[model samples]
Target: MCRGQTAQKSKRAKPYLDAENAEKMGEHLRSDYRDAVDFGGETGLRPGELCGLHANYVDRERGWMWVREVLVARRRVIRSFPKDEDVRAVPLTPKAIEILDRQLKGRNLTHGCGLEHTDGTECASALVFLSKRGRPMRPDGVGACVRLASKKAEVPAVSLYATRRGFATRAAEGGLDVFALADVMGHGDIRQSREYVQQTPTVRARVIAALGQAPPLTVIHGAAGASLGADRDQQPPSETGIEANENAC
Candidate 1:
């Protein structure tokens, strides 16, 4: 060890937005934006992935959504693929589907990108979520909205990413396997998914309960009467190292 060097500190996991806090935040959010927050938490989608979701990618009947692209929030550019280039199919819960249905209602599925391009070019875009002005929803805008809502709701301020983390934490506490969680969350590395499953009081209690249900150990002897005549206060032959000599003789 170097005498002048300082030990590196481990990074702390970000606080997750549980259901109670989410409901509080929702109260202060606009109706449309509230749906976005709920949808994000329900599906565990990244902010870019959520903003880039399009009508064509949703399979309402099949209850799945294909994640194939991402919206770079700062630049407002739509990329052809999501982070880590991991295209995936995320299963939607009934609540998630309902949110999507509401957003899709009365919208032009064939409409092009609502935001005006700098080059005056209109590209094909049927984004599932948009601002009240009909422009594409940016990740930064989502974060700002979440922050403002949290402040108004008198809850700890959290970014849009907290919704994704919240989903992961809930899944972990619900006994979802880490490997499956990774796939569902579109994580390229399984270790990233394991961070959400780290030891907590709920997890510890589950472990204790499982241990209590384990079968009791049984001790088998060569014969039922093997030690019947032995001195009750004496140590067993095995413990005294006498059994080895008897077996050798």
Candidate 2:
């Protein structure tokens, strides 16, 4: 077991669930926070950003969600800045949009969490995920719920941060480059975003397969192949059924 200084010097812990396992974990969670779990798995938003999500920032028609602010759990405050202090837009999959749609129908936008915009207009947009008392959710509460659900689902135990890692992994699998993944993750440094992506066996296999030394047999018998080699090289155009066009430039 790594302890003390050794633990500190070891690779930073990065836990994540693949897409399928993440869905299974969501299945075991109670209805109260189930959507939150699903959303996290899909969007890869930070816990504070998830808790701070507002209806106004969601553009269902465009299929995008803007990360404008975060719920500062420790301070018990709503701040108009993400962890990197940079606002970013994250694309939504159809499944993610579905989760948001359901939450939109059930939430009372006139009340609940509120945020003060920078333009001197104090908007009282309701948070997407809220507590029983209609306040912003804390990270501790969210993490506890994730652990309970993971145990029930019989999947690997993963923290809420794992959802972010999962999203990064899924994105990488879908062919997103490191720089683009960094932007979507709201990461200030590309290196931090690179840490989120995990290489899977399937990806490794593909890389190896691309190095094959020979082409498929079908290619050798095809038009291009038939035109190549011995007799064909000495054959006249007429014998090969190849004709020259008089109109050619």
Candidate 3:
């Protein structure tokens, strides 16, 4: 008897919150960080990039923000560039603009670090998102808030990275190509951006519908043992003709 073959289980991608769930999560998030979480969903920015955003980099007139730096959460230090040195510009949505305007209102261009450093000295920087104490927001701290909010919202617990992935998934569903997605996400490789796009039922339906709309293919056969060829312009043969041709082959 032949041995039975086992099918391998496919690994599931990380969970991501859509716009509706994001709003639900926001309702449960601390007011102080609600805008930060919302902005993350809008821009698809990594938590570090979001934390290191500066007033100088925001081009409000053009509706774009440059990802020039990242705050290292563990060391509480600011790096000049983001991961993979993938500095890129993210276009601001109307919602993102509103969030920025609110955060920047009456805020100084620069300030001392809100959190105490290892040396017991404050790091001076101009960061966009800050804690209630006016300190730089850490990725882990934002993640903690997201987890708590997810629980309260009765959604799957997600990290800050989920916000970024959610952004990518939304963009993909909106017909944005992987190349553009990669650029906006500050991904050095297109494959990294591709991974963020989930193949949801809607996307799969779109693909199937698109393929279904294509013109029907016509098969042409030549001499004996000839390979089959498609001629889209050629009309299909009648059933009787098709049977006759098969018998001839």
Candidate 4:
């Protein structure tokens, strides 16, 4: 709230769902934006990570992109430049690599998404993601894109970071272990990335199933009444190791 904004977000605004819903919304994006957003969501990249993307960043042969820079902004319009200089390589799923390859082939070589390239220049000006006008996007532009996507998909609000969260969440829900998910999501602090494990569909369903199954537990706990407890115990138990002992009643 301290970025000098006036209007506060509504308290009643719904919570954001992570990657699954975001992936669903990806279908609604305009082709370029769709690739960008979906790639971001799938790969767990931030807006600056997406915007600062360069042609050479993509290693199509290796099926990975070297993420070297990030555009950190004090504010949306007023922005600083890319900060991560060491160049981190992130694996590209086939779809992600395809998006980068196609964008490079299709868009302006001179200025695409606010980036350009020159032969033998100290740094190739090739920006991987660009606005139609060939300018780097402000954070607000990135946010708005997510908003439009959210509206279309009718899911929770998502941001650049949300993509990262979703990347971790979706992977965990899909059955990735903590170490694997952390590697994919690139969290320097394992704790941050590890948190997404709680959001996994497995975890959610377990919580829900546990809640839904609580009545039997209660019946077993309080009711010595044999018929009622037997009836209570008859509710479908999980295929997993969860045990049902009617005698607990």
The alpha-carbon RMSD values of the candidates against the true structure, listed in the order shown, are: 25.1, 25.0, 22.1, 19.3
Between prediction 2 and prediction 3, which has the larger TM-score? 3
The global C-alpha lDDT for each of the candidates, from Candidate 1 onward, is 0.69, 0.65, 0.67, 0.54
> Judged by lDDT against the true structure, how good is candidate 3?
0.67
**What tens digits encode model 4's per-residue C-alpha lDDT throughout 1-249?**
231112114321213335467677776665666667777766777666776666766778978777766643222221223345334568888878777777777655543223222221354346676555444544445555666666677665455455655566667778888877666665666676556676444665578688874322311000111111123233443222111222110
Give the alpha carbon lDDT tens digit for every residue of 5-75 in model 3: 11111233445667877888899887767889889999998877888777778898999998866765544
- Model 3 residue runs over 4 Å out of place are 1-12, 82-85, 110-125, 196-198, 207-249
Using TM-score as the measure, the top candidate is: 1
Give the TM-scores of the predictions, in the order they appear: 0.73, 0.71, 0.72, 0.63
Cα lDDT, model 3, residue 65: 90
Best by lDDT: 1
Looking at model 2, report the run of 10 residues with the lowest lDDT sum.
219-228
Ten contiguous residues minimizing lDDT sum, candidate 3: 240-249
Tell me the spans in candidate 4 whose CA falls farther than 4 Å from its real position: 1-20, 73-87, 106-121, 207-249
Candidate 1 lDDT score at position 172: 89
In TM-score terms, candidate 4 sits at: 0.63
**In what order do the candidates fall by TM-score, top score first?**
1, 3, 2, 4
